[model samples]
Target: MVYFNERDLCYNSIYPHNNSWTMSRIELDACAECDLLLTPARPAVGDKARCPRCGYLLQRPRKQSVARTFALSLTGLILILPANLLPLVGIKVLGNTRDGTLWSGVLTLYREDMWAIAILVFLSSILVPLINIVLSVLVSGHLYFRRPNRYLPYWMRWLQHLEEWAMLEVYMLGIIVACVKLASMADLRFGFGLYAFIALLIVNALLASCLDPYLFWRRIEQLQHNHRHEN
Candidate 1:
């Protein structure tokens, strides 16, 4: 991927690589992530393009992408309770066994005076996931409804902000590391919450991958534009 100035992208797209190419086609597209001007090319259904500089997905048109993302977001949101309330794992230590849910673990930590770590764990693992799921649903809902939204930019920015803090991947890595360390120390058992967590990660990641912010913004722009014309 090549880094491109937003100005250059806009300008070059107006200019031409060659007169013949320009004469034949004149559509210009911008990379959502980098604002790199891309010559528009019609792609097959399964085709996808990525920005060379940022590896940001440029275009990947699909049937029902917004609908699918909305569905996935709903599924993830529904799983939130199971992922946190059910037992994440059962642990056996010195012949004593106990099953621990996320809240249970947090309570245990708090009781043990590890409030800071407990808070950190709860926020990253629980709260962040919830916010990400909720925001995803909202974003996809807007696309699905295609309503006039004056706060489109703010909505997208809010989602992006929440996205940066939603650390399910990091928390999962921490869990894996902890599991490995505890292998020899005790008998470890995976539980419903653990499975739910895994599923949540899969669904949320899928939602993120399917969502194209650029497409979202464009849709919003079109809707607002149409609304204006109607008015």
Candidate 2:
């Protein structure tokens, strides 16, 4: 049975129908963009549910979401250090060579008294992405193991909001622009870190694609409910 709270516009389920059942599970959820209350259908794998009014996507089922997200997030976590710490590119001009790493770039900006830009870059390019990946791992890992954690809901909420602030693609675009501008002026060489950064970017993209937020919220709710009953 689906019990919806009108006050918060959230649904609480009791004895939710199994996926194997012929009937689609009904759950109430509010559209994030329009705040319209909706009873989204449980989408089949490869299917999607959309808000009728705004056309905002409400749900999309991803097969093996927990395992896929966990693996990709772990890979991203492994790549983060090298991507930020190691030199991304090397430049040579008149027998002088200089290499640039993400961390070094932020430090350079700060040293030049562009602290505001430095902090912005650091948060958007590095810190936020790290947090996003870490939270993905934590939430997906617990869900994969069928372990319940009271903080899962909080982590998932943060993960959803943090997606916008993780600007790795923007940073990569800036790198490409700089490389094109410098190509005519000096010898340019790509570093291992560049490849690592690219891989991390791809993994993050895949992680986002594989995560099913609707499924995750339902699983977290079920897990927490079961835990409370057991206690």
Candidate 3:
């Protein structure tokens, strides 16, 4: 069952469904854009509902979306180890070969006194992905355990905001471009870490792209409600 206090949404006291004898919770929600009262239809998997007034997408119930996201997040998290620990690229310059990990790039930048770029690279390329993986695990694991963090709503919202700043995919593209430019001058070989980094990039992209705020709130509500009753 879904429950929301209208006051939280700046309700106008307009009761479109004023009729009595309601068995369900009315499936009511407000559009974030226009505050239109929307009673979402029970959509099947892969189906979407749109608000009639403003054409905003109300809901698209993707089955196992949370599970899929969790799996990808876990995979990306595992890849982070190899992505940083193993060598990412092997450059053969004049028949002398050397490989470097992601951290090595950051260290190189730091050694050159390019602190700003080095920090940016470390945060966006490494720290951001780590945060996303942790957030996904924490939130998704809470839901799985039917437990509530009490501040999970705020935590989840904060995570969403942080997600906007992640640049792992762009970082990967930069790596690809760099390799392409150096291909003629040196025989470039990808290391195991590079392969892991690529996989992490793909899953991280999917995790960020397919996430739905509405669905997240809904799941949080369910977990919180269940936890309260269990007390």
lDDT of 3 by residue, 123-206 (tens): 887887788788887777676666788977876876887886678778788888999999989999889988888888888877
- Lowest summed lDDT across 10 adjacent residues in model 2 is found at 1-10
Worst 10 residues of 1 by lDDT: 1-10
TM-score of 2: 0.87
User: Lowest summed-lDDT stretch of 10 residues in model 3?
Assistant: 1-10
Better of 2 and 3 by lDDT: 2
Model 2 lDDT on a 0 to 1 scale: 0.87
Q: After superposition, how far is residue 143 of candidate 3 from its true place, in Å?
A: 0.5
lDDT (Cα, tens digit) per residue for candidate 1, span 1-231: 222223444555666467565432225666677776666554445567677667776667666778988899999999898998988878899989988787887788999999999998888778877987887787778778886667766777788777877788887897889899999999999998899989998998888787766567667667777888999
Clashing pairs in 3: none
Tell me the spans in candidate 3 whose CA falls farther than 4 Å from its real position.
1-28, 33-37, 50-58
Given candidate 3, what's the lDDT at residue 16?
Answer: 44
Is candidate 1 or 2 superior in lDDT? 2
Candidate 2 lDDT tens digits, 1-231: 122233433233543557664433344567788887766666678787777667777788889998999999999999999998888999999999999999988999999999999999999999999999999999999999989998999999999999999999999999999999999999999999999999999998899899998889888988897999999
Please tell me which model should have the higher TM-score, number 1 or number 3. 3
